[model samples]
Target: MLIANYLLTCGILQANAASGMAVHDDCKLKFLELKAKRTYRYIIYKIEEKQKQVVVEKLGEPANGYEDFTASLPADECRYAVYDFDFVTEENCQKSRIFFIAWSPDTSRVRSKMIYASSKDRFKRELDGIQVELQATDPTEMGLDVFKSRVN
Candidate 1:
């Protein structure tokens, strides 16, 4: 009887650990969606783990003009606009930000990154491709910025 009780307790603990890992995994997926939507020209993503925020840094001084954008994400089943940025740059310059998600005890450290595209159309297309890739990915193969180029 004692052995049976010990086994049962271990099983319950394992189940709770599994639950926590699932929650963390979901958070990572949500963060990825947010990152893909934010990609644009003259910007890159720098993921920071310490603070739970995405920092949008300007790529030097804007030479020509600034373009504004609003990025939305689903949080708690309701859509929220997480970022509104007035992005400025020269013809081929760039910017970057780190999108941080809190650490979970059950899962390894996870974060998301956004890369700005030089061409608006190309950025949109890249984002679309990222969406497709996310849909088809399993947990083993998920990675950040796989389809994006780093700014020079």
Candidate 2:
């Protein structure tokens, strides 16, 4: 009961107040372009552990693809990302979906993973209009097939 009460599930993430991290104001402003203005294809975020804040790591241009989004994440670290994926339905129509991804690669340190996992919910709630939420711990988990499967 104590563990359940401590880790509250918020939307697609678990909220752990232990970290007490704050979401930087700029994080939302940047997401607006991707969510409303369609100016960005993706946005990557990293936690400034020392500062106890989440900050934007990178913003993908409208011309960027899913591949670019995946490549932006470091091989041995954990990060958060948002991607504006444009897909065509069987009806030959164009549609787009915004995805919120929590990238916690297995190679990352235990402490680092714990921090990211704990802070994820606080950071994710700052952005609006995320249609899909994905938690990936390996490169294979972030592949296009996995994305396609989840997109539906």
Top-TM-score structure, candidate number: 2
Candidate 1 achieves a global lDDT of 0.26
| TM-score of model 1 vs. true structure | 0.20
Candidate 2 lDDT, 1-152, residue by residue in tens: 45534444422223433544788998999998889999899999998876778899999999988778888999999999998888887788899889899999888876677778777787777887889999999878778887777766
The C-alpha TM-scores of every prediction are 0.20, 0.86
lDDT of each: 0.26, 0.82
User: Scored by Cα lDDT, where does model 2 land?
Assistant: 0.82
Which window of 10 residues has the lowest lDDT sum in candidate 1? 110-119
- CA lDDT, candidate 2, residue 21: 76
Candidate 1 per-residue C-alpha lDDT over 30-77 given as tens digits, one digit per residue, 9 for 90 to 100: 344545654332232222223322233322122312222111121111
Badly placed stretches (over 4 Å) of model 1 are 1-20, 24-28, 39-93, 101-152
Model 1, position 68, has a per-residue lDDT of: 26
